[model samples]
Target: MKIYDIPGFPNPLRIRIVLAEKQLASQVEFVKVDLPAAEHKQAAFLKINPTGTVPVLELDDGTRIAECTAITEYLDNLDGDPILTGKTARDKGVIHMMQKRAESELIDPVGIYFHHATAGLGDALREYKHPQWTARAEWGKLQGEKAVAGMRYFDSVLEAQPYVAGDAFSMADITVWAGLLFAHFARIDVPDDCNALRAWKERVDGRASVVNPA
Candidate 1:
């Protein structure tokens, strides 16, 4: 299988981290897209994913899989492994619930505030390039602050558990890790009160798959 990735981007990195966690690194071929060049916007690239996002998986049989969540779920269903996404209905529900919260409350809002207010993808992504919004930096900053509150809530949940969905390190953890890692890169501050989250984050970061993928 072939996977298209962008090293610095959060979406691709999410899958990369999961690939490491699953020990599937060596099993897949990686194709890196030049994000700064806006290569993803080209028609050739769009054929694989109409959305033109990175971390697209192309099976040897010519089937294409895109979106980080879907890709991770696909990996979970394949080969019947450790069941990170969950082997039971209750586990799946919990994992998906946490995933939903992390994505909706933290990930989406933070990215939106950053891109729209800070002109994050202005140079590479044409759609979000509106200088008028940059002038509303304060408003965007407030949105970021709101996002941080959600992070705190998420942190509280993670503090008591080994992973997002309780004791198991599932795709929900991967999703949260990718978002928080990207938020750190984006220069957002993590609250000092979140000791559990901090500790958990370190544990996840220290895994061999995350640190030195095969």
Candidate 2:
């Protein structure tokens, strides 16, 4: 198996964490997806992933599966019963719910703010240029602010639990970890006042797999 990835990108990080947790890092090959020059927009990549998103999984038989969450689900359930994602129907329900909430509440806003709203990446995303999106740029900045508030709610959740959804570290934790790291890099304040969350982030960051891959 192979994984199309980009370091510093949250979505790809989610998949990488899953690989580490599953102890399957050595079983797959990782191909770096270059976003600076818009390599994902090139025809070669479009052939493999129409959406041009990173973290696409390539089966040995030459099939490709895109989207980070779906890829995480695939890897988690490989051993059967969807342990990390959810072992029971209720677990699956809450995990998926919380995961999506994090995306909508925190991660998506960052993407809109950093990539679409800011003119920082003038030449990096050549293909995304459009009059409509240009007009919507200001919204991204405001959305980023909202994302910070949403993340605080997450901080509160972490205050009560060792992980995102509950005691056991699950996919939700990976999603939050990856997204928060990106926010940190983007100069977003993670509210140092959230003592519990601050501590949790430190612990999660200590995972060797995140700092070094197999």
**Global lDDT scores for all candidate models:** 0.78, 0.80
How would you encode candidate 2's per-residue C-alpha lDDT over 27-134 as one tens digit per residue?
Answer: 898899888778887899999898876879998999789987888888887777565788888888889988997788887777667776666455868456545775
The segments of candidate 2 whose C-alpha lies over 4 angstroms from its true place after superposition are 120-122, 126-130
Report lDDT (Cα) of residue 93, candidate 1: 89
* TM-score winner: 2
Alpha-carbon RMSD, candidate 1: 2.3
Candidate 1 C-alpha lDDT tens digits along 1-214:
8999877677787788777777788889889887667788889999989886788999989999998778888876777864667888899889889888878877766776776666566576755244565555766677688778877987889767778899888877777777787677667778888887788889988877667643
